[model samples]
Target: MKNKIGILALLLLSQVCFSQLLTRKLIHGQVVNDSINVENVVVFNANSKTGTVTSSQGFFSINVRENDTLVFSGLQFKSKKYVYSDIKGIDLKIKLEIFTHQLSEVVVSNKNNIKPIQGSQSIVDKKYFDDEKSSSKNRTMMQVGGVENPMDFVRMYKDVFKILKKKYPKKTDFTTQTDFTEIVMKKIGYSFFTNKLKLNDDAIKLFLVYCENESKARMFSKSTTEFELMDFLIVKNMEFKKITAINK
Candidate 1:
């Protein structure tokens, strides 16, 4: 009976200790002027792995301790972070402002009666334009060697920041989608493409056009490995042949 009593007492003591572990405080936040409780507001603790989403009533419960930073993100507003100590209460009333994007208007004219491309008002395939091409900054971040051209290095740095911003929260994406396609073309010069794929000048240009149209052009960056990029291009070459054959 004594042994049983002692074991029971120890177990009860352990339970009490476990329950007394880090104090849990409720952090309440509201989106001001939001008639409906904004649903799916992401609450993330940048300091730790603690995260949660707000409810339809614009209410969320998260287990947080003191000194934990909470970053709130939503589609309708700019992402904001609140440090637990910065605000002394469990409840936080937040106002989310809509983010605006300024874009130049594009007018499309069909003088050549080209097929209208999907996703944009362009009468012709938008791929010919450098900015219209899909680009990936992941390749830029993966670059290992040094860049001799100062301008290229600057562009690469810009791309890296754009990548980091897009990766977190994923609200935006970064593309080296300016006139940089020329830089890419110069990097993967005719000699490089000819030696790798054994293609003539005309064929290579056509291949480039195909890559742009297919949105596969971004894979060829200075940081891309020769073997991998070549493999991708070769496969795409075969697919391009099949496509051209069908069109003819």
Candidate 2:
């Protein structure tokens, strides 16, 4: 009995040491950008939920582990993510792309051929002015007429509601959160969870629940692209695997 107890204690000690070795460690990293202002750029480790900000020189340090996802976000730069794996050295260098805004095309045209009016004289035709005034008055009269009957107002409301419902279905109406999750699962396919992530059926369901609780994964159903959803799943998978290993 004494020998068996000693072996069990040794096994437990080894497991504890192994778990500690797998834990995250502080890593020094730098953000590379072409622009001069790199200050205050957020460097976040999604796995650990810890973050740091870059200095004026774009240097930052944060805790990270193998397969950890580091997200860089800032006002002036497009958001970027880096997975830490097979890194040889202690320092990491990540590059950021500057954000650019493209304005919609605007056309400046003198279609009316109307010059600036001199004193009381007008350059445009009097008939044109009269036509514009008559159209504006007609629109005002139509609005002022309003709905004649209470039933007519209700019918108009129902018609508008139907149009909105067809365009954008409410979550409580036809789809619940579970429905959204299932839709996403179908879109991504079962093979991805099993083949790429190496997750069993039960584990996949559990992982989805974990993501929903931790990262609000259901919110992705709103406006996320396939690429964006895949990126999120990849990062969440790394974190999920880390948590599972720790629990073991």
Candidate 3:
């Protein structure tokens, strides 16, 4: 009985050690490539079943463990994954590559094996071909599209999006936050003041007004982690409440 109890305690200790394999890494991730900051990019980890989307500034943070697979998915770009072991650090930047699809046209000549449907009559699906954009995953189209001229296929695939832009108009207005002060304010959201800091409405209004003064705004920004930022706010929470007699 004494031996069994000792073994059980050892097993329990081992279980605890195994559970502590990963430290909750404070990650500041940016979704971008060499040129653009890709907002709305989905950052997911299948192993942990956890995920987050990039903010308008293309920023995100989540606790991830070692060996976790971080999948970066978005509508405009190809979905890519990076193992957490490969991304274990403060400088977490994910660069995304654009996706293009390839397709081929096969015209069957009744007599011979194949030829370009005789003269300039064109294929049967004229309108369809004009509007059709193939997907990269369409193996059937790729098989039919021919065993391929990759460069031509990529060029033609790109033209599909251009045609789409003409057919439908979308707002492309993009502006980055140039003012460092404004960038700081956006990082610490309004909810943090009410919920985390527990500041009253009147005090919150005054603090927001105070942030515009430059010195106070220095505490918040993209570089600051959420926990560290919250700590700073907690200090401010005490200071501001005291100065206004609200703490009394």
Return the candidate ranking by lDDT, descending. 2, 3, 1
TM-score of 3: 0.35
lDDT of 3 by residue, 1-248 (tens): 99999999999999987886755565777888766667766566567655666677878876677787777766567668788763357558788887667668765566854556654334532333232455434546536655553355665676797999889988542233333335435667877777977877655655443333324454454555667756666765564454334112
Error of 2 at 142 (Å): 40
Q: Write down the TM-score for model 1.
A: 0.34
Question: In lDDT terms, which candidate is top?
Answer: 2
List model 1 lDDT by residue over 26-64, tens digit each.
Answer: 656665544434755556666654556556666666656
lDDT of each: 0.59, 0.69, 0.62
Model 3 misplaced regions, further than 4 Å: 1-19, 101-248
lDDT, candidate 2, equals 0.69
Candidate 2 structure quality by residue, lDDT tens digits, 83-164: 8874546698888898888889986886877567565334322334446655545545555555633355665787798999
Better of 1 and 3 by lDDT: 3
Error of 2 at 47 (Å): 1.1
lDDT of 1 at 224: 54
